[model samples]
Target: MSSKDEKNLTQVTDKISAMDEPRRSTMQRVHDVIMTAAPALKPRIWYGMPAYAASASAPALITLRNDERINLALTEKAPFRAAGGVDGQLMPAAWYLEDLDDATETRVAEIVRSVVG
Candidate 1:
């Protein structure tokens, strides 16, 4: 990683570490999921939050905050886009599968693999 990217990741980790435990834990869980599933992708801090992509390539994915929810933002330029959410609504900057149950986690793993592989 470049010095700038390292700085950004450090800033993100610091900000997340400062959050309350519940919120921090939630972000950590998401981070763990992304890192484990997409080893080729690098995690970086974007707009004070965590984002991952295939090593500074095009099509970045971001984790964004919307009200009480956290959502993933896959670039509009991404080959695959999530369906159903309207643009510029109260929706998050990106779309992620709503039900993160065991099945959903597996699906998320598959999606990450497809994108990063």
Candidate 2:
């Protein structure tokens, strides 16, 4: 990793480590799930959060905030078409979802597989 990327990762890890129990647990759960599912992926800090992708060479599929929310940025036209009428209104490659549940977790794993596999 570049020196800048290492610094960013350090910042994100520190921020996540400082979160309260609920938020920290949530972030750790999501991080664990992603790491388990994609053993080859690399993690980095992006937008003040923990982000994982197939590699720094690939696009990020998951980003977890210290506030215990997971952010999924949709990069394909399919997600926009599948968004239906969500409040965020899909915008090609700019869709993001927060505060996911168990079902959301499954859905996220599917999305990650599709994107990174």
Candidate 3:
């Protein structure tokens, strides 16, 4: 990672640490799952939210959004495809989570490993 990226990752981590309640804990776990599953993905902040990318300044592979629920979005440009309902003929861009259970973590890890390979 570049110096800029390292700085940004630190900034992103700080932001995650500062978040309130479930979002904070959820994002941290998501961060860990992605990093552990795919060490090649670099953590950063995108649009003021936590995101992971294939490289410095690249578009996010997955992003954590604190909406009505926690959202783990797989970018359209990402390597592996996600299965879900269609949106005007296009697949939905992400997976939503109310909580990170063990099953969810395992599935997320499996996706990350497949994509990062």
Query: How close is every model to the real structure, measured as TM-score?
Result: 0.65, 0.58, 0.83
Lowest summed lDDT across 10 adjacent residues in model 3 is found at: 80-89
Best model per TM-score: 3
By lDDT rank, best first, the candidates go 3, 1, 2
Model 3 lDDT tens row, 3-105: 9778978987898899898789988898899889988888888888888888887888778888788888877667644454653445545778878899999
lDDT of 3: 0.81
lDDT per residue (tens digit) for residues 35-67 in model 1: 789776767665556777566544466454423
Error of 1 at 102 (Å): 3.6
Q: Candidate 2: lDDT over CA atoms?
A: 0.59
- Report, for every candidate in turn, its global Cα lDDT versus the true structure: 0.60, 0.59, 0.81
Ten consecutive residues with minimal summed lDDT in candidate 1? 90-99
Candidate 2 lDDT tens digits, 1-117: 667556655766677778776667666666666666666656777666677655665665566544334445533322233445663554434324454578866866665565456
Stretches of candidate 3 above 4 Å error?
80-92
The backbone clash count of each candidate, in order, is 1, 0, 0
